[model samples]
Target: MYENCLKGHSALVTGSARRLGRAVALELARAGADVIIHCNSSKAEAEAVKKEAIALGVDATVLSADFSVDGGAEGLIEAAFEVAPDLNLLVNSASVFPSNRLAEVTLGDINSNVLVNAWAPFVLSRSFAARAKSGSIVNMLDSRITDFDHSHAAYHMSKHMLALLTRLSAMEFAPSVAVNGVAPGLVLPPVDMDAKGGAADAQYLAGMASGLPLKKHGEPEDVAKAVLFLLASSFITGQIIYVDGGRHIRGGE
Candidate 1:
């Protein structure tokens, strides 16, 4: 359904190496949008995504950055424009999920989470709006932001901040730039886990699914579909699409 929907447009999907981010980028390419794949330390995987996008008949490139570094978003925005002068979509999908209870969370953990998950996306959205004639943004979030995750104190806090940022940027960038968010639950294994979908990770998700409304986990493509919907939308902004199979609304997801 998205074929030629985004023809002539361009996008940048941060952390578009091998997980949910990669799925989002590939979907954009399938819709005929040239894309810049952003990564922190997944160059080889990012390159593979770029090749996949290129195979889909759209321009693709990789831009890496250390999002924890101050002002890092500025360079990413610069490179996005350079790679695709008509860059119009920014997908803030790169994030770090650290497990730490509130009592045990360290200053560094808080700092890192806030910088990459919250600050980087905020800065990139601001800059993208400043330069683009018209475009859209999609920030990746966790469904737990609506409730809470005691085991992921810093991560949850940063996601809450990003949710607010999405609303603020949507209000601020109105009439020109559209800002939105996609919150996923039990979609992919954490970066620290066996990304190859090992037995342990599958068992964990299988167990996690038992508590969700759908009684099952979601796929990266689910979130990617939500992103594409938001991008194709013209009257939607300051909104969030949760790809958690009713988990966010039904509770116990």
Candidate 2:
């Protein structure tokens, strides 16, 4: 369905070295777009993804930057433009997921979460909108933004603000660029998750999905497909597509 829609288009995907970010980057390359894969410390994995993209006959570049600092997001954007000045798509998929209950959360935790998950996407979106010829931006959000996750209070709040930013940016950058978000539920857990933690998260997500009409957990590609739709659709903007196996409809059931 995305054939030739992205031909000759250039895309920059932040935190795209592995997992969902890598999946999205490869998917875009498969659809005929040159890709800039951004990573923090996954240089080898990023290069692997780049090789895969090159095998698909698309130009690929790997960029490394820590998006958790004050100026990291802008620096990433500037680096991307330096590689491909006429960039057409930006994917804000890089994020920091720290687990801390509200009672124990510190100012440092809150600031770090907000900077990486919320503010970085906002700054990168604004930067892309200003320089893009005709561009689209997809922000990676979490379904937990709607339902409270007590263990990840700060992270949840940061994603909540990102959802708002997606809407407001859609209005602010309208008629020039399209801004939208994809909120994925239980696609992939953090790399550091232990067996117990992974199983617990999986069970929780499965329980949530059981009440949904789809009755299944989602995959990263499911989210990527929704993103490709947004990029291809000429009229869609300022929207949040939940690729969560309909879990959002359960309303925390």
Which number leads on TM-score?
1
* Clashing pairs for predicted structure model 1, backbone only: none
**lDDT of candidate 1?**
0.90
CA lDDT scores, all candidates in order = 0.90, 0.88
TM value for model 2? 0.93
Which stretch of 10 consecutive residues in model 1 shows the poorest summed lDDT? Answer: 188-197
Q: Give the per-residue lDDT of model 1 (tens digit) for 1-253.
A: 7778999999999989978999999999999999999999989999999999999999998999989887688998998898788889989999998789999999999899999999999998899999999999999998888786888899999999999999999999998999999999888777666545578778888987887888899989989989999999899999988888667877642
Give lDDT tens digits, candidate 2, residues 66-170: 877668888999999999998989999998888899999999988999999989999999999999978899999988776778878889889999999999999
Clashing pairs in 2: none
Give me the overall lDDT of model 2: 0.88
